[model samples]
Target: MRKIDAADARLLEAVQQDAHLTAEQLGAACGLSPTAALKRLKRLRADGIIEREAALVSPRALGYAIMAVVMVTLDREDRGVIDRFKQDIRNTPQITSGYYITGDADFILTIVARDMDEYDDFTREFFYDRHPTKTFKTCVVMSAVKTNGALPVHDLAQSAI
Candidate 1:
């Protein structure tokens, strides 16, 4: 695994909380000057430590208020089937997140839709109609308790040492 220092950890944590923070702000937060902060950030990006930066748009605001978590089981675990399913998940805009998981299910998916009808259509087209999918269960989210993607950088930095 790649190693990172305490200052790097601080910068990552701070930037995750607010990606728009200026170099000066990040520097002040992480005990580095603006130039040093910029350099470190550049190195981090060049090293692929920082992935894509994006704004988190609300589903409700976008008129896609319905969200569901689905667990899926496949009929076969062959490489071709898995790859095709993964490709479908990647291409489908409604499927916000998909994971090839263990235990009772083969895959877990988080989907968003404008309403129940759209969600049903998604299930019918993506799960029911898909050849690889044997069975699937869905849990429509009533309310989201939290939706943050901040990593525990403090713990990560400590563990690296």
Candidate 2:
């Protein structure tokens, strides 16, 4: 892992908030010269600390009106089933993210679709007919109270310096 200093931590925090910032802007925010800031940013990207930068588009604006968090309990927890299910999830674009979980559910998925009809189609294709899912429960999002996708840089406080 690349050693990140206080300046790097400050730089990371600023960039996470806004990835579109120019080198000059980043330097000013992080108390570095433009040259130093650019160097660290390149290092961060090369070391894979800063992953892909992408635009966070609004699902509603894109006509994806439904967001569902689904807790899925599989019929079997065997290695083959788990592997296959993970692959299936990877191929399914509607499933934005999935976590292998503990407790009542084997996996939890964050899904988005155009509407209830599209959501139903997804369930029919992935859950009801073909998949090994035993029971799945969904909670449709009424309103997103918080959607900060940025990871916390404060956790690196001790190590960063």
Candidate 3:
């Protein structure tokens, strides 16, 4: 990885929070001129330090009021089966995020649905009818106390030294 100086680090932190910040604003935050800030941002992009920007959307506003975390255990020694299951999970729109884990479960999935009834339909159609999922468990999220998109830049900067 490319080593980032304090100014670059500050720019990254500020941009992660608000990518819409003007070059002048970012410059003011980092004590650089607007032209210099723009140049540094360009270099960051060229070096792949800045990957992409995205807008975080609220699931409730999008008609998905329930959030669920599902742990899926599949039959071992079946690569084809695992791949098929992954593809099926990816194809389902309700599944927002998924990861293949190294622990007790083969995969973990984060899902969003309108309500319990919608989740029930998803479970019956995807888990019961369509796939070869062995054992599974789900935990409904009562509340998300804290969430942030920012990376731990301080820790990363320390480790890089």
Q: Which stretches of candidate 3 lie over 4 Å from their true place?
A: 158-161
Ranking by lDDT: 2, 1, 3
TM-score of 1: 0.94
Whole-model Cα lDDT per candidate? Answer: 0.87, 0.88, 0.83
TM-score of each: 0.94, 0.91, 0.85
**Best model per TM-score:** 1
- Which candidate number maximizes lDDT? 2
- Please give, for residues 1-161, the per-residue lDDT of candidate 2 as tens digits: 66677788888898888999998999997788999999989999999999878787788998989999999999999999999899988998898889998998999999999999999999988997878889999999998887757887755754533
For candidate 1, list the clashing residue pairs, or say none.
Answer: none
Pairs that clash in candidate 2? none
RMSD of 1: 2.0
Q: Kindly report which residue pairs in candidate 3 clash with one another.
A: none
- In candidate 1, what are the lDDT values of residues 33-122, reduced to their tens digit? 989988988888889999878888798889998999999999999999999999999998988889999999999999999999988987
Write the residue-wise lDDT of candidate 3 on 1-161 in tens digits.
89787778778888888889998999986679989998998999999988877887888899888999999887553888788888887888899888988988999998999999999999888877877768789999988765556885643453221
lDDT of 1 at 12: 92
